[model samples]
Target chain A: MASLIPLTAPDDPRIDAYRVIKERDLVGRGGRFIVEGRTVLDVALSPRNRFTLESLLLAESRIEALAPLLAQAPADLPVYTASQAILDGITGFHIHRGLLGIGLRGAEPSMAELIASLPEEALVVVPLGITNHDNVGGIMRNAAAFGADAALFDFASCDPLYRKAIRVSVGGSLMVPFAREGSAEAILDRLAASGFTLIALSPSGASELSTLARPPRAALLLGAEGPGLAPHILARTLTTRIAMAGNFDSLNVATTSGIALHAMRRTQITPA
Target chain B: MASLIPLTAPDDPRIDAYRVIKERDLVGRGGRFIVEGRTVLDVALSPRNRFTLESLLLAESRIEALAPLLAQAPADLPVYTASQAILDGITGFHIHRGLLGIGLRGAEPSMAELIASLPEEALVVVPLGITNHDNVGGIMRNAAAFGADAALFDFASCDPLYRKAIRVSVGGSLMVPFAREGSAEAILDRLAASGFTLIALSPSGASELSTLARPPRAALLLGAEGPGLAPHILARTLTTRIAMAGNFDSLNVATTSGIALHAMRRTQITPA
Candidate 1:
């Protein structure tokens, strides 16, 4: 069992990474990201989790309930306990959920490295120009629910490891494998080289989603809500459309991913 | 054409409804709701819009770009223009989009009236215990995109007209017909009386959503993410589920609705 380390001061350098969470830029702190709340903490503390768990800072009152999960922490993991007031002062806003952790994002595999690591019948979510953290998180949640093997992000997309993104994803970001690599075309090229069918979701696609027969390995391309897939990207990839009623084809990109993934799963080809 | 009336003061009684919007309770003020941004404003200003358009408070700068849509506003509708600083002073936050309007919520139909008004062939969404505005908004968006005839919310559900909800829905809440009335059981009873097939979406459902045969008039039931449809509700309705991989079936209610609506649409039976 992991012992709790009491934190008497808000500015203790020992908990430096946990300080000023609200004002700090979300860019990883020397390759570390923050995980919030109990749900995601379970994922971070799980066996064989891809991301490295460095430490946890939690409200003291929550110790009893979280004791079970904390039992799984590594021997060297530091579990810092603080009063709710101390917790609020350390972080800029009220950490109402009161459970936080510092995690090592580690180095993501390169585009070619990611492709080489994929399983034969892998399903991947390829997001381009996704600026909103919620959209990426929702996509990861759907990816986890639909059994997507991995996700590959283009240059302009937001990091799935963003604090809010991980919280919104309900730890699906941690469960699924992902990497933010080169430009959109470069990532697509690697997927193509790996024999993956590239499906770009657009309103003016050539084939209806329900009727399309999906291949064993496929990459689903998603763009921001309004400016969808770039023209060059759409021209080369198989453009697919979800049949909608009337002129309203404006499904949120995240919701669109759920529908597309479900439809693709219907006719999913099994790998040899 | 809407004639712009310049308002120099933040506390002008004429713009009382738009005051301190951030601090105001979401409860409709004298049966009126607030609409933010130009997109939803368009829906409220339409010729046959059900909601009554009270007035508009624009940041003066936005007035020029919004001329076309403003031209369509009713002759008597007030179009008040103000400096961005004055707009911020009145609303208690930066009106970055610089467009806001007050719309009368009007009288919503009772459960029986809503049921009686359904088209011969209709697709309805029934959301229960949805406290989150984003989830409800996202569900309405999907409802509009997939041609759902109307949506019925149990008493526990939040109002779609909540400021953030309308924004999150991208104005879809204004486009779709919805009624927030009755308890879960009472609403389900009315739908059944109207010859609507009640399909409750649950992870452990009896039939896969893809394989289920939908009827001419169907009502899709959704619940909040964790405490999904109460067991009693599930026992009385035809429980259907979207197929998932492994054990993770925790799809967001809005995402679940999108997938279910898309699947039901595949074999949607039209009116006789």
Candidate 2:
């Protein structure tokens, strides 16, 4: 079991790494990312989790409820507990979910290396220019739920490790195999080089998802909501649309990904 | 054009109806709900929108950009413009999206009436135990995107008109037809009465979505993410699951609804 350390002050210098989260988010997580809520923490500690949990800071009230999860942590891990008031002061937010931890990102391969490593009959979700944390997290969750082998993010997408994204993903960011970094073209090049059939999702794609042919390797590429896929990107890939009703704008990009990913799995995984 | 009324104070009694939003929410909505952002406002003013745009409170700078939408509102509708600071004060939050409106929900049919009125080829989304506004909004947004005839919500579901729900929905709550009321059994009873084939989605459902046969009228039923549908509830409906990999709990209920709705469309609407 991790060691418990009582904390009376929110300003204790021992927790400086927690404060370094967003800066590391911009510069690269210094190998550290924040996870919030017991639901995510549960995943971060599971055997399948790709990352390592380094430490935890919890509100005094949450300790009992989170005991089973904490009991599974590394014996040497430091568990800091503070009053709810101090916990709020430490996070600088009244909206804290009372459970927070820092996960150490493992040594990761580049987007190119990851794509080249996909197994045959692979299903992959590729997101480009997705800057919304919630959407990024949702896509990650969908990717994991649908059994996609991997999720690749283009340079413009938000970090899935951002606390909000991790929380939204229900720890999917930690559970799924993911690699980020590369321009859209760079990522697309790798996918194509690996003989992956790319399906670019758009509100105005030439064909609907039902018509997409089964490929040995299928990669569904989704872009940000309003801009959707770049025209050139669509031109090079088989562009598919999720049919919708009326003249309203398209579905949320994350929701679109879930639908498309599920469709891909039907052909790739469950070939009924 | 709706006349723009300059507002100098946050406490002005003229916006009392906006103040009554949540209180009205728990009750019958007093026939009034709130919409936020220009995107939703555009839909509220569109010809197909069911609600009446009674008033708008905007950040002073937003008026210029929103003029096109405001021009379409009823000429007598009150358009209040306030500085961002006063707008924040009025909303009691720093996160104000700078656009708020009061929408008058027209006299609506009950859940039974709404379901009973569906066309022969109809699609409906039914959410049970869905209390999160974001999920509620996302479900409604998916409902609109898939061209479902209407969304029917059980009593345990949250209001789709909550300001946050509306914003997350991208105006879908306003664009889509919806009815909320009734217990789980009552709602299910009405769906059966309407001759709707209710497909209750569960992670462990007996059949996969890819194999679901098309019904003349299909209602995709989703439950809260963690608890999902009650066991008794599952026994009554055709239980269907989305194919998945190693168990990751499940996809967000709204995402499940989207994928299911899209799958239904392929069979019900497109008939491919």
Candidate 3:
């Protein structure tokens, strides 16, 4: 079991990483991320995820409830306990959930290295220009929920590891293997070269999603909310649309990812 | 065309409804609600919706840009103009979108009245305990996007007409007809009485979504993120689940609505 280090002073250098968390979230720490809440910490501690927990800071009131979790962590890891006021002082805001952890990103594999390691019948989600952190997180959650082997993001997309994104994803962002590399075209070229069928989601697409047949290996290409997939990207894949009523033509990109991924999963089991 | 009334002071009694909008948004202003931004105001102005506009407030620079919309408004309706600073003072914050409208909810029909009005082959979305305004708004957007005839919300659900919900829905809450009334069981009974097939969405559902055949008249019963549908509600309806991978079982309720609605729409055309 890890040792419980009491933290009475807010300015202690050991807990400096937890200071002004909201501001630090803007200019993210290099190779490190904050995991908040007991539920997310549970995911972070799981051996399946690639994140390594550096330390944990818990509110005194919550330590008793989280004893089992703390007992499982490596003995060398420091577990700190602080009053709610001290915790708030460190985080620069009221953290009602009262559990926080600093985590380091594991070695990130190159896009080629990641893709080559996937199973032969892999399903993946590719996001382009999805700059909203919430959408990126939501997509990761959906990808994990729907059994997508991995997520490939273009450089234009927001970081999936952003604090708010990680929290919103319920830590599914950490569990899902993702790599943000290359331009949209370059990623598309690589996916196509790997014998993956590229399917671009767009409102103007000719084929309805229900009627389109899924390939043995599929990569769903999604874009930002308003502008949707760029014309060049749409041209390079089988363009399919989620049919909508005439009055409203759009769905939030994250929600679109869920529907598209679910549809892809269905097609895999029951061929169209 | 709407007559442009010039407002020189933020404390003007005629514009009292716009004061401290964020706070007023909590209790809400009796039967009235504020609509923000150009996109949402566009939906509020549509003649098909059941909202009646009391007045409009626009930023000075936006007056000329919104001329077409102003021309379509009832001639006697007042369109107020204020400088950005004055608008900010009245709203207790920066009004960056700069367009606002005060709309009165028209007579809300009884649940029976609303359900009875739907077509014989209607598809509906029923949210049981969705207290979050964003989720309610998102569900409304998905309902509108996928052509669900109406939304039926139980008392446990948040007000779909709430300001934040309306904004998050991109005005979808206005375009789609929705009513929050009765308990979950009462609403289910009403729907069943109206010849609608009740299908509850739950993580523990026995049937996969793709395998379930669509009913001619369907009502998708949904719940909040964590608790999902209550046990009794699930027992009363045909429980269905979106087949998820073993690692993660949850999807955001709004995303689930979108996927389920799309699946229902697809099944309507291409029977299982």
Candidate 1 vs candidate 2: which has greater DockQ?
2
Give the true-contact fraction for every prediction, in order.
0.76, 0.88, 0.88
User: For each candidate, what is chain B's TM-score?
Assistant: 0.93, 0.90, 0.93
Q: How well is candidate 2 docked (DockQ)?
A: 0.71
* Pairs in clash, predicted candidate 2: none
> What TM-score is obtained by chain A of candidate 3?
0.93
Error of 3 at B81 (Å): 1.8
All candidates: TM-score: 0.94, 0.89, 0.94
- Tens-place lDDT digits, model 2, residues A1-272: 88789998878998887655545543336677888777888887778688888789888888898899898888888999989878767766643567778888878877867877788778889999999988999998888887889999987888887777888888888888888897989888888888888888877778888777768788899888777788889989988888888577568888888888888777644331
DockQ comparisons of all candidates to the true complex: 0.68, 0.71, 0.81
lDDT score, candidate 1, position A62: 90
lDDT of 1 at B212: 86
Q: After superposing candidate 1, which stretches have Cα over 4 Å from the reference?
A: A23-25, A270-272, B23-25, B270-272
Off by over 4 Å in 3: A269-272, B1-3, B26-29, B64-74, B269-272
Residues forming the 10-long window of minimal summed lDDT in candidate 2 chain B: B19-28
Of the two candidates 1 and 2, the one with more favorable TM-score, higher being better, is 1
In terms of lDDT, model 3 sits at 0.85
